[model samples]
Target: MNELISQAIAQWQLMHSIELVATLLALAYVILALQQSLWCWPAALLSTVLFTHVMWQSALLSDALLQLYYAGMALYGWWRWQQLKQGSAGSRGPVYEWPWQRHCWLIMATAVAGLALGAVMANYTHAEFAYLDAQTTVFSVMATWLVARKLVSNWLYWVVIDAVSIYVYAQKHLYFLTGLFMLYTVIAIAGYFIWRSHYQQQPAVRLSV
Candidate 1:
């Protein structure tokens, strides 16, 4: 395992040219979004475009497609969050959540979709470690939905997604990326608690309102 890790790090360092920077940029985007900064969307858009190219270079077509999803989501999230904020009628921020009912639906739907995606990847794709990749991909689609909604619980999804990506990237010898995911694991924990506290203060802002 140590030898493999070392080998992974060696190769990753050699390929650190553009992708590494894009990864860090993406991380910064998430950090800002966690802090409830709307600017994070545009900041993330740059990384997504950069990653599209980087993933193409790595021949990760699905992963590259993930960046395209990010682009679309970023636009949607930017618009949605802005409208919510503007609609706040004064000082209220738009950090509200989906009701628990909708939340459960998101989870159930995400699970079913993730399973279907995993099967397709496991059976029909050239994606490295296909089951895991597809699982992460589908989780991401769900997670992206949550983020767009500005649901505080999205941080919990981030933790799960990051945990899964750690193993996925590690196997692909993307050690730097794996390390970044480990950092995301830590950040997700912080983000969850932080967002939770924020939501607790604003419990009055349920989806109905």
Candidate 2:
């Protein structure tokens, strides 16, 4: 076990400086986001920008593109959160649960999108783990949007996405990334329960309003 740890550390040391920075920032983003801190969006933006370069260099085209998407989403999420914090009349209410029917439809949509993108990448590019990449990308896009919308169920989607990402990163010998996603999985679980408690209070908040 020590040897494995040492080797993983050695591998990480050999990785690009930007990758290391991105990993740290990504961790910060997840932690702060879980705490509902406004600072999380900036952390996510920087992390995704660095990761875009990292994934592009690693020849993971889909992931690289996904990082760009994440960067954009970070900005949108920041603005959305700000609006919510300001109590704008047009802004959506507190964290809430999506209906099961909506989640079912989302899952089906994500699968179909992943399959389509995977086929395109497999046929037109040399991208590694095309299907897995697409799966993670599709779900992550939806999950991030859910987070921005303050949906309580977003963390549940992230648990699955992060778990799959661990394998995807491991296959590329990105041990640090694998470790990061593993942490994300655990944090995502914690996020679900945390948000659930907050969600339960929404009814009371509304009643008192």
Q: Highest lDDT among the candidates is held by which one?
A: 2
- Give the clashing residue pairs of candidate 2, or none: none
lDDT of 2 at 27: 98
Q: Which ten residues in a row have the lowest lDDT in candidate 1?
A: 89-98
Clash totals, every prediction: 0, 0
87-186 in candidate 1: lDDT tens per residue? 7753436565666787787778877876787677666766666556666777787788778887777888889889988887787676667888898999
User: How big is the positional error of residue 189 in model 2, measured in Å on the Cα after superposition?
Assistant: 0.3
- Please give the distance, in angstroms, between residue 154's alpha carbon in candidate 2 and its true position after superposition: 0.5
RMSD of every candidate to native, in Å, equals 5.1, 5.8
True-vs-predicted CA distance for residue 118, candidate 1, Å: 2.9
* RMSD versus native structure for model 1: 5.1
Tens digit per residue, CA lDDT, model 2, 9-75: 9765655577888999999999998888878999999999989988987888899999999999999
